[model samples]
Target: MTDSKDLDQVRSEIDTLDQQLQELINRRAGLAQEVADIKMAEAQQARADGAESAEVVFYRPEREAQVLARIMERNQGPLPAKNVAAIFREIMSACLALERPMQVAYLGPEGTFTQAAAIKHFGHAVLDVSQDTIAGVFNQVESGQCNYGVVPVENSTEGMVNHTLDNFMDSGLQICGEVELRIHHHLLAAAHTSAADIVKIYTHQQTLAQCRDWLEAHWPQVEKIAVSSNAMGARLAASEPGAAAIGGDMAATQYELQRLAENIEDNPDNTTRFLIIGSEEVLPSGNDKTSIIVASRNRPGALFALLEPFRQAGVSLTRLDTRPSRTEKWAYVFFIEFEGHLRDPNVAAIVAQLEEQSILLKPLGSYPKAVI
Candidate 1:
């Protein structure tokens, strides 16, 4: 669009701009290294696979999402969401480098949703291990073999994962954190398949529950196979024609299986909540929750003493469950979840009162509630 003189002048300006950009990028990298060093102490001791720990901790997606959301709310930028997210991803990667690595355990044989959730929360920064059971996951963290453990607490379709609840009562693990994963299911097959030809479906018992109505109506005559894990079912389905597996999209892709159907879950809004447990206590967010197991002496006023403090503190009690106590007849452990942290003055005062009066008191850790 211009002459020789103009072209030369433009080239000179372009070179200047390139130099500035290079300097800015170099400065950013230096800052990242400096920040990563600070986080190294914590992340370094973490048990997650070394490479995963580096990436996940280094790039904290959740915190970045929160910050970028706030920035957009304020709207003082030329950056788009993706660009901003990317920038912060780099920044968080630096931040993670500042702390020691975190190790997280899960119930698994691999490619399980719990593993996915652990990765989601910890960012690929953790050492992910699949134990034989939920109790094992809890015990691993409790014994300090791992930094944290992830276990399913509840699912919208499956009610509660009772195995985890039972472990909660039996173990000394703290609920350090929580996360919800939006579940998506795929109909996977090893052989070529079509919806009309699929007669049998293989999946986990929980997955079966999620798709009960659909399965009953769609393939009433076919046998429903319950497998140990969705990935295992998917692997089975891949080897057999006329059979299909209900699992996440990743499993389907992992085996190079074609998806006969997607979004097969009956409820479009289904989600699962997972717990992160650690051996030690957690620092509470300003807005926090506390869970405790209260066992009172069989006397009349014992239960009342525990309830009175909560009422006085203006705490909202969300849940209370009575479980058979291991020790005595007619005695039960009343597991309670309430709004407020152990560190809150009012909550601490109530806990102190409960300690003196209750036969057994277990503080299950104060943590931020899952938002989504």
Candidate 2:
């Protein structure tokens, strides 16, 4: 219904709008740099005033969360709110990099889901360090080698990532944010390999489980071998003859493999939840969640006693999981996630009450819930 002349005029207007957008983005970046400078001055003043441990923090999780939320709230567009927020996420990421580039560590060989999650949470401007293990990711963040770490906590299909949960028990790192990534697995082979020639299939154990039904239905006779990671599987598939890998699009692209079958997971809505760990505690974002670990005395109804206060305070419990307390045989530690920031009056009162009921009540962190 549109004419060529009108289209040409609209295209010209769009180009002008893009130029204005670029100018505004650069101006925002300049303001972020100024904010960094002011923070540096405050740090210096604190040190001069005998506050020796003061350090300037350029990234404010709560502030960024608030900004993203406001952006979504103000969105009036043909584009969806999430799409608008994602655009602002990159803009904020670039602005933050102008001040100080964030270093993020994740469990990876480069193309793993954790890497994707890290990018999703921190945006593309961050410096991503690929650690061989989830514990390594935690160690890097704890040692201050990276500003943040991303680790998988649970998969919708596979439940908990025990290694990550166990590491949290030992580490003091705070949960700064969370990201949920929808997973789509593909059956991939090297470009030269054909479907009939594929005898061996490689993938991570979880990936193998996810695609179990699909593999049985199609490549029933194929030898299924579990590898360390999906990235490694794709790597092997790329190098070996008559080999295929079960992994996501990222790995297939990164390893230059050809997709034979896409979205082969048994579950259509497969998803994984990853947590962003950091050394600093996040202040209250308007909407936030708090995570904690509680070890109660070995007694019947101990958990009920521990949780009763939350119910009494009208606090909503989001998740609760129990793990064996390594220090004591047969004793258990409960990991709890609840809505509301720890600083909230109801949350604070509930935490006080929980401490009295449990042998150990460790407040992991209060952070903004996932914004995008």
Candidate 3:
């Protein structure tokens, strides 16, 4: 038999800790409210002084990134670092909401992975607006209908989101932050579905490709259909007989479907990288990354001329992608991502050199690297 006195003592300690945490959280919220009031006053003063550009923006991506990083760094816990950071995320979200609720747009119809990424980066306190297309997400943010937008940029299993990359060519929105999500696809069906009766499978093209091997091995005879989003696949499967959808656990749960198989992806460590888009430029948070698009002249060694500056400066390049330039035939625009903020001296020099050599150079924005 368990010791009743010992159990009671432990429970009492936990209760005390919970009460203390609640009190501290509320105190933090009160401070956030005061900060908001001060910011409003400052904005009013700026307007009165005829400073048209000085607007009060509550959401600071760099600051939030630094805070999350500090929380992860200081963690010495029985619980995992991410779990602790996630708890703090909700606390910060609630406090920020006390200042002002943020509105974020994402590629979605709800239950999509982009929506999950938005919540992960912004926390659940912000309002989430779902758009049917990547263009829609960008357009909403650009039109001031939403403060920010989250869109998939690349996948570890798949290479890159071409549409998102292309959209950056014309959009004026900035890359404010980023989030990486570990994707695990599940084979889900409705409650009444039977394995033997399944004749068609539904999923996003990327999801279908990710699980190509498994599906080919098990359900080779079943017809695979590509949908706009995984959430759409789940919705279709829920209403159609003898239909199964390959999607994430979130979609399965949202559609009330049963998981016939879990982690059916071809690769075990599949992850998708998402970018947060907004209008404001973020200040440096110590560790940062800058993304840019460069179009070189149509000549020999054009690419080499564009990249030589970074090599000369000994800057670390994280990613480089090439897309056809919409304005020029047989010419391409290179999307490059590198470490260090644009404000850094070495990085600034390198960018200046590249601008001198390249036909066109556009700095997307510099923001802190992903913390969680």
Q: Model 1 over residues 78-143: C-alpha lDDT tens digits?
A: 766545544554444434544555567997757778887876666664568888788789888888
Better of 1 and 3 by TM-score: 3
Sort the predicted structures by TM-score, highest score first.
3, 2, 1
Across residues 264-284, which tens digit of lDDT does each residue of candidate 3 receive? 999999999999999999999
Write down the lDDT of every candidate, Cα atoms only.
0.76, 0.92, 0.93
Residue by residue across 35-93, what tens digits does model 2's lDDT show? 99999999999999999698889999999899999999999998999999999888989
294: Cα error in model 1, Å: 1.9
Report the number of the highest-TM-score candidate.
3
Q: What is the TM-score of each candidate against the true structure?
A: 0.76, 0.97, 0.98
**Counting only residues 3 or more apart in sequence or on different chains, how many pairs clash (N, Cα, C under 3 Å) in candidate 2?**
0
Which model is ahead, 1 or 2, in terms of lDDT? Answer: 2
Q: Can you rank all candidates by lDDT, best first?
A: 3, 2, 1
Span of 10 residues, lowest total lDDT, candidate 1: 53-62
What is candidate 1's CA lDDT for residue 38? 60
